[model samples]
Target: MDQRKYNIYFHTHTISGIIIAALLYVIFFAGSFAFFKDSISAWQKAETHAKIIHADYNYLIDSLSKTTNLQGRDFDFYLLNSRQGAYINMSASKDTTISKPAAIKSKSKRRGQGDGAYFLYFFANKQPTTYAEGYDMGEFLYRLHFLAPLNQIPIRLGAPFGYLLAGIVSFLFLFALITGLLLHWDKIKANFFLFRPWSKWKTVWTDMHTVLGVIGFPFQLIFAVTGVILITNFALTTPFSHFLYDGKQEQLFEDLQYNRTIEVPYSYTSLDKDFDLNAFVSKWEQQWQGSPISRIHIRNFKDQNMQVVLEAKPNPSQRFAGSGFVKQNIATGEVLASKSPVEDANYVDGVRSLIYHLHFGDFGGTALRLVFFVLGLMGCAVIISGIMIWLVARNKNNIPLYKRRFNFWASNVFLSACLAMLPVTAFTFIMLKVLPEINQAAIYRVYFYSWLILSIYLIALRNPSKVNLHTLLLSGIFCLFVPLVNGFTTGLWWWKTWSSEANGIFLIDTIFLLLGAASIMAFWKVRKQAKSFQVLLGK
Candidate 1:
């Protein structure tokens, strides 16, 4: 509360917030939608998660076996992102001396065709699709939350540049939040109830920034910490692994329960009995009824020493945080190791699950996720207001003209980048329905290119009021078109989807419609107040 401490806190907070305002806005805006990632994916494909049947792994494996010998190959089936399907990750056979399975050429540009590849197999359609083909706006926005697209940038920073940058921003965001809280510590209680939307721009932005920042502090704090932990695991864990585990990073990961290695020798002799994957999976599923099987790994394929590893995580609603792992020998039906997801939970499981659930809002279902999404958007509001406050605070006669100009330019660029995302995202969603192609490349091109064009245009305007108003107008139009085009293309209008009880698909249409309505309402209000809101700060 002292003057010296207050000034330090104020300066550090301002610097950090300004440094990360734009990127943090992207993270919040994209992450808010990511809360509905599954719903968005289901909506795009016109499929209901509740209605779609679970994957028919047996049929998929059988179909795959016909194409390539299933023997001696290692297989990993992941249901983490499965929607009426399973992910198949087939590895080359462990027995190098034996004849290998038929090589399936990878259709992706990332890697060459070898003895293996991975793809999603939809049981409803009875077909397979590569990850790129299966990519949807849900995945796009989810990955965009942490700037995954930035990974394509040719940069080396001793780690993935995108992830490393995201982590650094997250860490700095935490510092800013702490400093901001401290700076306002004396007036926190009084400011908690303050609002002055009709006041001068500076006071209005300052009040909004402080009030919302305080209100969303805990929520954003959780996100900041978990985000750093999630994105910077490489940077944070490396030193500890090097020291404690003697550079055996794998061992450190195993100890933390992040990964487990079940080693089984590849016996040359083939198994005499048939390996029934369905029966094996079904048996475990039945035994662990409430806990979902997260992953299944088969090593050595049909060889005598083949082992099947089943990893399960307790449903958040059921037990919150537990890991279940069972490794069993296929040839002899012998259980080599086992752990109960509900009963055998540990400290690591609790910490890991707590972080994931808190960050993701997965514990309380759709309603809680909606609350989280609203708070995320509120976080976006706080960042914008903070930036505006920074600009307005520097727009005084005492400030140097050049310094004021720099501040205004900084705010202009940051706001342009941040606000452009709203319309660009809605535009991309509309494109998803109308475009002929719907793959990763298509999504990337549409979203990024449109974003660039719109951002450049906004920056050219040089007027923050115009930039804000125009983005709102564009966002309103595009967001409204999202549900309309989706209805026309998929024949699943609001009423029809609601009647069918397809909650997942219905939720997507509903959210976009609401967003469109809100954007339009704000646009109308802003247009009426354009003259007053339009502050020529630098000028």
Candidate 2:
């Protein structure tokens, strides 16, 4: 490449990377942990996914029918991947003759005019709990990856601005990755072999950034593309929707197979036949043996015109496939439309599944997810080193003092914010065990407040190296306590879980054990340097 073009590539990459660095770090870090979200939930709840291979749908419906009137209503059951529980949703009865129940009504402002009940149902324990009671660190970190919590802000730009921001960051990150690859194109091969721990600060940072960035290029690039598409698909498709579907978003989504819309008009006639839902569900389960039923949507329940849509995902181990659903007429016992996941999946299913599985890293099971998590951590390392390089390159006497000061301050803030996440997350896991009766509000308070306090304190130190030191030490201590705390609270230690075949719960404990070990090792090395008053790590 010519000098001018090289300069352009370098500057563009630097600016774009810097612009999204901190936010991108949050996404990557939180997302890395989110790969184990299910395991984390299982671990924290002290439940074993292995024990619950199937949910008792019959018992679930029976339990729900006992509490609420099931006539002429819509019901949705969303099964968790863990198979241990599900989300039970009940909408207001479709029959206008039936009035809203006074027991369920509230003066809540954010609620819609129509009332609905959403709660969690544990299949294994046969118990119901509020959604708040089901909240866990896994869900929190997963939402954090896409900045979903930020949607709580009142600002609306025709859509959720939090997702908009995340999409923008992902797009910019893709741009930076492209420009960076181009900037390093000429020396790519040679750079692959470059590593010098003893080099000057700027050189060390540059080498670390280049090496890890190259190594993680494909994984990062996949996330960048898929993250943007997944988060902003609706927004991005609006213009195309106008052209293709005559401006109907619902039509476009249906056409693209993102969802299957069934508008079942009520006949307003009561059904005389007694339907055994358990026997009905059992028939389908037997038909679709290996595949798990993920969701069921019942419209106009117990009515003559009732319709049930059953959706299921194919078992990837049998054959990698997306999913398909069946729509059935309840009264006539007729199959309205069928798309068997085991036999025929539409092209849209293939495309959507690829994007979903690749982005979420759920296709290949635990081994693949662990590999992806390591790559995600490597992405974090690249981001941190890039920030270090940005600071060191500008920390010169020749640079204006104001610019130098601003650069240093920016680096301090970014490093503090990013590094603090390690210890804060570990701390949250420990707290998850220590706290009694954890819930959504409690988790938010514990995590965000702890993170805020630690970040503010680190920023006060005003040294990037010191931020790294403290975060490492704190991360080591807190992470080491995670499994220990869980054992103390739940009696499910590493040995016990593994021996009991509760691998999902064991996965989380093992992950924290490894992370705690690595952090402590790094902390020990850094502590030794501190004793000698060496600045090698600061380099």
Candidate 3:
């Protein structure tokens, strides 16, 4: 390529990357952890430490039916494969129009606080128990990954702005991926495996960025495309409904079978007196064969015309967005309708399912999730290094001192955002371990305030880079102690957890230990770079 063309590509790449660097880092960092969301949730609740015993599903159902008057109510039954415990969640409202399921409400004095739902827990050979609240560290992190908003905006408008910004950044990310490949096309093969830690800082960063970007190119592309698709799906669906389906959204959904719901007429007589849940479960198992039923939703419980919807575990080979559903008559145990991606999905539906599976890394279990998590972090590193390279390039040019100072400060702000996330996340983990009963809403406040304080410190400091180094060092220390905190609070040490059935807790502790080691190494590398830069500048 000629110098003019090269310059144009270089400038385009740098400009586009800088525009969304901080946001990309935040998204990637949170998303990496989200791959282990369920494990995190289990770890948060210390579910493994709880006394668990095998319970007969039929016995639990029969007991609930006899003990509770569930007439004209909606309820959900959740069964976990890892433990013998089960949960039955009865919503507050009997109205079919109520979309949101009731959560166990907490009695914490904090305003707007509630436990997830009122749930009855069942175990073998023991009386059923109930809980008023549940922790949500995993769910919160998953939401923060996709729903994080700019701090400057009004809180009410944050969601819409955050979504819009995410869509825009994802689109730009796709563009960057294409342009990046084009710019590196000439030397791609030659530099595919190149790395030189002893080289100049900018050179090392450039090599690291290139190697990571190239190695994870396919993963990055999948994330970018799926991210845009997910964010813009509703926006595109609305227009397509209007133009293609005459504004009949239901018609569109029917065609896609995306939001299929089974509607049965209401009956005045109560059927709970004669309903045999064990028979229904047996029929469902017979139909689905090996698939485990995860959740069961009963609409208008006790009513003669009640409908039961059972969602079976997703087929590993199907690669769909959700588990298949079997809708049945609650009174007759008759199957009404069923849909499984493995059995009935059309080409378009299968493609949609594959897209979700690829994006979420759900198909290949823990090994694939681990791969996605590492690549996601590497994506963050790519963004951070790109910004650093841009800053270094600017400093090498003959720019005005004022402009240079502005760039320097801007780079510090960006670096601070990236580095602060580690400590903030570590602190949040520690807080959850130390105060397991803390209000769920308070968790978000802690995370937000910690990030805010660190950001303000970065902006106000005279030597931001030095502060960045110190913050990283502190983050390392915090991370290193997280396992100890968890052990102290839960009495489930890593060694014990490792031997127990709840390996998720053990895995989480190990991850923290490794992350702490990585953070310490990062601190050392940054400190060395700072010294090198100072000597170069004769400071």
Give me the overall lDDT of model 1: 0.86
Q: Which candidate would rank higher by lDDT, 1 or 2?
A: 1
Model 2: ten consecutive residues of lowest lDDT: 530-539
lDDT of each: 0.86, 0.84, 0.73
Off by over 4 Å in 1: 50-52, 109-113, 530-539
Q: Estimate, for each residue in 1-539, the C-alpha lDDT of model 1 and write its tens digit.
A: 67899889989999999999999999999999999988888888888555547656778778878887777777777785443667778876676676765577556423323577788767788887888898899999999999888998888686777888899999999999999999888889977989987877788888989999999999999999999999988788899989998999889889888887867777788988887787888899899988878889899888998999999987787788988989999888889899999888889999999989999999898999999999999999999999988887877779888888888888999999999998899888888888988999999999999999999999889888889899999999998998899899999899988988889888988998999999999999989874555545546
Give candidate 3 regions above 4 Å deviation.
2-8, 49-69, 74-133, 148-159, 317-323, 462-464, 525-531, 534-539
Q: What tens digits encode model 2's per-residue C-alpha lDDT throughout 1-539?
A: 99999999899999999999999999999999999988888887888655435567777777667666767878778888876787877777778876556333322213222666677878778877776777888899999999989999988876687898899999999989999999999899988969887666677778999999998999999999999999989788999889988899888888787767768888789876877666777778778877788888888888999898888888776757667688888789899898788788767777888888889988788999999999999999999999988887888778877788888888888989999998899888888888877988999999999989999999988767678888998988888888898888889988999999988778988888898899999988876754321222222
lDDT of 3 at 298: 76
TM-score of each: 0.97, 0.95, 0.83
Clashing pairs in 3: 103-116, 103-117, 104-115, 104-116, 104-117, 104-118, 105-115, 106-115
RMSD of each: 1.7, 2.7, 5.2
Highest lDDT model number: 1
